[model samples]
Target: MPEHSYLGLASAMHRLTELVIRAAMSELSFPSLSGRASCGLDAACGNGDHSIWLAQALLPEGQVTGLDICREGLLQARKASAKAGLADKLAYIQGDLHSLPFRDRAFDWAWCADCLWPGPKSQGFLGMDPMPVLEELVRVVRPGGLIAILFWSSQRLLPGHPYLEARLNATRAACYPFQEGGSFLDHILSAPVWLHQAGLEKIRGQTFVADLHTAVDGQAGDDLAACFQMLWGRAMPELSEADKAQFERLCHKSSPDFIANRPGYYGFITYTLFFGLVTSRPR
Candidate 1:
């Protein structure tokens, strides 16, 4: 497997956590039962930011276990868990989503964000379809367990918005087969309906919409540019040297104002978080 360094990717992922938090806060309602005293699970927890956040929110006696397919990501998550002094209450694991490697009904709350997309050819990570992974998440949680998931939505991000659009286009140009048809809605939103198929009840699905805001002359703008580069910029590497150079020149020319953080460069990027919850009843 080609080791993709997510160090840069992690930063963008953390920035997007705000979207996930808002989704969890609004879409999914906690049971009258205490979340703090409850145990939780984070599926496909890349770097574990969501897990750590949940731990802080549900602290006092709650524990959160984060699982990821990538070992490097898991290691980073473990470090974060420890740094937060949550090592004792938090756990990180390297595991396949198809086979969760944990017992059934193991948790009360489950959370996962933006992980249903097909893996890259170089990574050979998870496949395009998330059905198997979905089954596992449903299986691991006990009856009455609260399950919250956010999958990719429609093309709300700009050409400047990173990751999904670029990756889909690149893979298609390279002639790769993707199951979800390159749209976040096609992939992630399908989960709510899938949960119903899996016999999950009280299935509620909603789109959490938010706009990305960046100041013209601040760290957020710098971070946004860096993120766009890390996610979509890398796809240009596959271009021929001359083509890459011309493309870079074109990009620079077209987005001079945006790159320079001009006042008008600030624009709203809209995204919808597809969140679903299921009562832990037996199917």
Candidate 2:
């Protein structure tokens, strides 16, 4: 089975993305959530950091609900929310993406990060597929509400991005079936067109790229270690010993080149984040 655990490096990467997202939001004039207006939804809010950010953005009146299928991730999100003292403004649910638990036209907007990927490693789960979940996120939000989905960009266009390259390498080696694991770029570069096919409209999208910097006063060591653990740990359970060993070696060796500024070295990697607005029309 594919690993479901969120790596610390992934979390750090996510936090960095959050920073860029907030900056982009400010640049885009995304209205701040007031205590009395503008509710929000975070689709597939793994570990709740993004959801909590939404909830915090709401302040006193703008409430938010986060939904995800992973009970463990949800639990972590809940804890984080509570710790941040935003529990009252935020709520969470474990639900199917094909059929969101919210009422029709419930939310003003929805945001999901890395949620629309293919189904979980386990069978018999909804939203293990990207297309339907995309449809559902668009469906639940009121017309004109915005949708933001973030994912790793393709390596070819952003070759300096080590994280994206590493992730793609590990995933490909793990034998992910889709041409791109149903990537964000695949959906975003094609924007409202893809959403149009999913029965969404007025789709406008913008892409932002941020470098995933690991070097922070020697924190790179732990960051790389956690990334390796997240990659190999999740894979080892299902892979053959030979494959597992090879993967281990790969994970172990990947950090050094990036760390020491050796020949053929690349700096912090880039991640692509995409945001769009859902329209009233089907296309």
RMSD (Cα, Å) for all candidates, in order, is 5.2, 5.7
Model 1, residue 2: C-alpha shift (Å): 12
Tell me the tens digit of each residue's lDDT in model 1 across 70-129: 887888889888898989879988887789998987877678676655555356546655
> Top model by lDDT, which number?
1
Off by over 4 Å in 1: 1-7, 16-27, 31-36, 118-125, 154-186, 234-256, 268-281
Please provide, for model 2 over 1-283, each residue's C-alpha lDDT reduced to its tens digit, 9 standing for 90 to 100: 1225442244754654566655444432335422236677888777788777666555367777888877887888889989999888889999867788888678877777655544454633233446767777777877777676665443321134445445445554333423454665343355445566666544555555544444442544445445445434544655666655554544453544333223332234234445566776654
Model 2 segments beyond 4 Å from truth?
1-3, 7-12, 24-29, 32-36, 58-60, 119-129, 154-171, 174-177, 180-192, 212-217, 228-266, 281-283
| lDDT (Cα atoms) of all candidates against the true structure | 0.61, 0.58
The residue pairs found clashing in candidate 2 are 35-61, 118-128, 119-128, 161-269
